[model samples]
Target: MTAHIPQSRFAPAEVVTRPQPGTAPTDRRPLWTVIALTAALTGLIMAGYVLTIGTWTVWAVVAMALITLTTLTLSLGAATAVVGLIFPAPRAPRPMPDWQPSSRTAILLTLCGEPPRGPAAMLAELAADLQRAGLDRFVDIFVISDTRDDKAKAEAEALAPLIGSGAITYRRRQENVGRKPGNISDWLDRWGGDYDFMLPLDADSRMSARRIRHLIHRMERSPSTGLLQSGMRLLPAETRFGQLQRSAQRIMGPTFLQGFSAWTGDAGNYWGHNALIRVRAFRDAVPLPKLSGVAPFGGDVLSHDFVEAAWMRRAGWRIEIDADTRASAEDGPQTLAEYHKRDRRWCQGNLQHLRLIAAPGLHPLSRLHMAVGVMGYLSAPLWLATLLLLATGAVPMAAGWMLLAVATLLAAPKLCGVARLMRQARGLRTKGVVLRAAALETVLSSILAPIVMVNHVVDVAQVFAGRDCGWKRPGGASLRLPTGGLEALAGTGIIALVAATNPSAVVWVLPVALPLVFAPLFIRFMEAPCACLMARA
Candidate 1:
């Protein structure tokens, strides 16, 4: 039953304890149709704007260019997603009739500055679940730390006795090296020889042992899948902003991910955690090549998971998500300040993907993934440009109609998702709940959007100026009124200009401006723990 790959520097002790599983085959022809449709929709909208405007002034040209780019990016999330919802893909990999894995799987908990008690306690509970399923023998837990904090390191070392003997092991690096990717790569170099699969989980991540077994079984049925990602839900939160995001995610996240899965098929992307990876495939194919030069776009890649998936696929492997499984959950940043901190780091990391978009020998889909990552952050600046032009009367008034069309396109995916969810639930009760949640989410998000936009603009500017954000844990603290107002100043200035130039424009501009004007109050209200608890009750 045990199949072993040839031992090399890539995996000195690699062993396949199980027979190679069957490859999960899929037809991807429909994906292209969806892509073409998305392109056509974006082009038609752009053409409508330019033709209606009937002028090509320098400012108009810049605004139109921004509009075109932002629309194309938005279309991927909206119009094409709506198409995928309308015609969903075959369901994700499920348990095979009589197949079981013969391989040992390592559950890696990568930590950096986090206290050990949290992950250790989670694993201890998981140990009991695995024991109940009689799968204890096939799994082991590893707490890999890159914590520079002495107290955190000490706390992690002290938890060894609590986790018991061989069921768990603790290891740390003297030098943090390439951040998270380095910590994981180091483990593979040292301990990867013993296991056929690795499930990398973030410190905040949790998944039941039954689900873990199911994931392994699914992988056993999917020989070609280099990595299998799971849908992660947000944990129950105790803050208004947290609750808002959680509600939005509950309503829309599955549909969004399913649509992505439909288009991606075998070329699915990898999130950093809540995923399983085949040892040999990852070891050989994803060696974590260092980018040339220094920080930002160069040196050690900030977003290693996406690039790793691309590298594995380049070496002939498939990546997929187990959409049917959704028990995995993690805590999110509770406050807007914390969210901004997290996003700033992500913005820099995503922007760095520009360097890899055209890397030689990449699959076209892989290239598209990189380009999408780059645009996720780059589009913010483009959006900012469009707003500035519109507010200053530099663009045509017909731009208002184009904006209306864009808003419709943006809402299409959510509308489709709710419709699909209603159908799947097969009852009016679920539909009512979804609608109520959607309305509340829309209101909360409208306020949050301007704050996020301004933060991303600053983050992108800093990254472009060669400023290294580096990695830091998010401190989930509510901002005082002063700090919050400072963040809102740019939006305040824009609103003032809009009010002075054209009173009629205030209605369209209020959505963005009102959020910024009252951002401090919004943050304070949403950050109130008591209010959050009352709302939950």
Candidate 2:
């Protein structure tokens, strides 16, 4: 007989009681199926590309092989995600029928120079919702500030008036030691023992009381769950980049989340914010140990959420993302420049995961998760290497069939997402919008790919060189050309080389080269206030 997942303990004097347990959830088939499919597809593409590398230098052949393999690794993930959409798994625990919270929860809101009014307003809204649901007594809010600036600190202080006697509290650390992870650890060390569950939210994160209650209910029903991450819907976007980013997310997020849930199951990862965690489990199992090196890859674990989840899983607790829920929301960056700026820090943090991928007691899938994070940045340099080899005729002309295979591997998952959305639509109206959005996004992504690749390549290099990608709070500055002079000259230089070497290759390489050549102009146009307004219109 299968062992039952542990049931949670409830405190006495609760108004509501428990419900009948529904299902035990013991399926790993979908995860293995996705892995098998990815491997098969990657192998097929690698074989096709290897067969086509005739007449090239051995080094060039090796370079092509490496590129093909790396690219396929990413492709395999996409394919797995598509498979997830097709065979979606239930991410939340079995429905708790008439479940009610049996423990107090603390909503830990982390602040780092964010506009205070925004969060204060969000808190008011959340408080009102909880009071209406009769859960104000069960849940309390904590604003943990890590702001170093005086003005920002004062701004955070202004939020104190919004807090009542005990339901809401505010505290700020004078020195932000390890950025966000450190800030969180500081709070956990001091006040974590007082609460049974802790729900961490970013400054921009928002969720309804009902949704929050549902999450707590799910957690209380499953004692083994260490984390319950909600998939947040992006709030309204006032700028062009934000509009496109959120639109793309709406179209593709579900399918991707479904696949992710399928593979990760109870061993899922965290996305930092908008997630509920068991206080005791987190405080006990996931104490982040400082690595023994310098900046970027060593010092503080920049990407601590993944590692924390790994540790929790190692200690026999479940970490899950409930994508089926839709009440949680957060803001996306309004411009491409802001997005890339955030990604710069993310790049460093993800690269830092290389140090912990081999940490003892971590599960195999958890190791794969960290390895994938490392590849996310490394793939850019590999792509650039492949392009340089092909552009300089160091490699023989890539066969049409091989290129087609590569395209299929890269594009098929996106097409599948679009197809899935269209099929699920209730009317022609949504279908039309989705089709337009998908096509537009596809074109935009192609245009932006090379520029982002170059950016990541630079970031990864800097990271390895021990560059400090410190804390940067978003929404502080307006968009300007993040990539301009040097990038433009480099793009032109590459274009010139391609033209002089092989004019026939110009068309194939032009799209990748143009964004670099006109980096400032592209950034300016894409981020101009008018363009964003027009996109919204």
C-alpha TM-score for every candidate: 0.90, 0.89
Where is model 1 more than 4 Å wrong at Cα? 1-24, 89-99, 426-429, 473-481, 500-504, 530-537
What local lDDT does model 2 show for residue 275? Answer: 92
For each candidate in the order shown, give its overall lDDT on alpha carbons: 0.75, 0.74
lDDT of 2 by residue, 184-253 (tens): 8888876665677899999899999888888898898787788888888888877665766776777677
- List the candidate 2 regions with Cα displacement exceeding 4 Å: 1-25, 89-99, 164-167, 399-403, 472-483, 530-537
RMSD of 2: 6.5
Query: For every model in order, what is the number of clashing pairs?
Result: 1, 1
Candidate 2 clash pair list: 84-259
Task: List, residue by residue over 355-396, the lDDT tens digit for candidate 1.
Answer: 887787887888888888888878877887787687667775
lDDT of 2: 0.74
